[model samples]
Target: MSLRTVAVLLADQAAVFEFGVLHEVFGIDRTAQGVPAFDLRVCAEHPERPVNLLNGLSLNVPHGLEGLLGADLVAVPATELREFSPALLTALRDAHDAGAIVLSVCSGAFLLGAAGLLDGRECSAHWMNTVDLAAAYPLARVNGDVLFVDEGDIITSAGTAAGIDACLHLVRRELGATVATTIARRMVVPPQRDGGQRQFVDMPIPECTGDSLRDVLQWMSEHLETEQSVASLARRASMSERTFARRFVAEAGTTPAKWLVLQRVGRARELLEGSNLGIDQVASRSGFGSAALLRHHFTRTVGVPPSDYRRSFSRALSA
Candidate 1:
């Protein structure tokens, strides 16, 4: 069935950021961008009841658990780790049994877990909570490192901003790239981020304050088409190879080689979504060397092959 209505469930002490992410993506009406409006509803366990928020504020949700019954997508934003009311759990399970796509952000996975919906499913949550989620829901396969995991029907995202990536992915998957890109453009965020990309970059070169590796990192991004190695990057940074490698990890939160592959994959995604380059050409431009190599890294990083990614996005634009 086509994705139309979206119901966001909020419980006690909901994290406003994750809830806002869902609202920003699914609740907004962006007809100007050729995106259809979603029937977005923020539901709580008690209709017209005030639900507390983390910031000491409260929200008066108008709908109750019944609101989830007909939703095409049911999103559970992060809430305090407490027992889910039986009504909410039943509604969630019923929504899943009825084939609605169920999604959770951060600790909201706990609600899905409580509903017994995450059993044996490959899921993810905030890194801080992954251990707890795993221990609590031993049957569920939990991965905390990636941005999000899309197991066809159920999608779970990591902390805060990763929710945006997962939501846009759902838009890109169900609606099309055009809608996702339009939403992302308005939001000033990337439409797609590889789900497998590490949650933390050692020093997070992009957010690095020190100037030590800044120049080298910028150069690498600008020249992804060229060969890059630790030795080459070290030379560019004017540091010894070992020093550069250590500093790179310290700042990037990942090894230089892994970081380089991620950069190439990111470039390939941009080319796939925005350009009409052939696989070989795209690979060459992104420094993947060959179509086979691109396919391997792209799939491993983005969770989909390049051709499939292009076709998915292209169809969105044409549609």
Candidate 2:
């Protein structure tokens, strides 16, 4: 396959950090591994003009909106100014219409929405802007709790670090997980995060006199293969089942049943990726009881069957 050209649109008062993320991922040459590296260029609506960044530093971009004509992908980083220039929006729309994949990092979704690229598309941005984005673009389905949303040609990510995840996702989709892992290793970031941004839930914590629930949680981890029940957990914590259920939800951010399922699925994933255990053995060890049960929840939660995930991760490790 031919090398892909990536054009990044730089706006006045653009976020410097978000732009740096694109450079860090796509600008670097990783040709030693025989993978095609992107040809990256910074384009502006006004060529040869100095634009001020969020950090008060000005950068001169020589390429005009015409640079986006030949790009295979166009990235618009988050801007300090909530609004985007009319020319830049038109350029982005032209790129999208010309068969280029359009991507946004954080508040860049606002620009895409202005260009009418986000209509009827599922997207994500920083959680703080979720309501406003949704209110502004009623046609766009805005999900703030995910790291990123991959809608084939148009993609959007939530917050700063998630931009890395979105970029790696593109790499994985285009070049496979092996190449993506290589880039992640060079960049010193995880190839994939465990859960979405929802896992970083913000909640008020009430001080507890004693952490009896913590003891039960530790015991549950140690004895995952053993049959677990709400009554058993309540007894272990020396509380009524009703009170234990409420306290467990408060402490864990999720219900006990949901938490147990997540833990079991996580264990199954570890065993599948790290060990050569068969499906049945993995199922039993992870407290799923049977392979069918494992397959049911694994497909529902992880979005892939156990065998396929193992094959992909295993190839990534060997690569």
Query: How does model 1 fare in lDDT?
Result: 0.87
Best by lDDT: 1
TM-score: model 1 vs. ground truth: 0.65
Per-residue lDDT over 1-319 for candidate 1, one digit per residue giving the tens place of the 0 to 100 score: 6889999999898999999999999988898779998999889888666998898999999888888888999999988855877888998999899989999999999999999989999999998899999999999999988889999999999999989999999989998898889999999886788777656423233344467888787888899988888888898888999998999888877787788888888888778888877889999999999999999988777666888777655543454
Error of 1 at 185 (Å): 0.2
lDDT values of the candidates?
A: 0.87, 0.83
The count of residue-pair clashes in candidate 2 stands at 0
CA RMSD (A), model 2 = 6.4
Measured with C-alpha atoms, the lDDT of residue 278 in candidate 2 is 89
- Model 1 weakest 10-residue run by lDDT: 200-209
Model 2 residue runs over 4 Å out of place are 1-3, 194-201, 204-319
Q: Which candidate is the best by TM-score?
A: 1
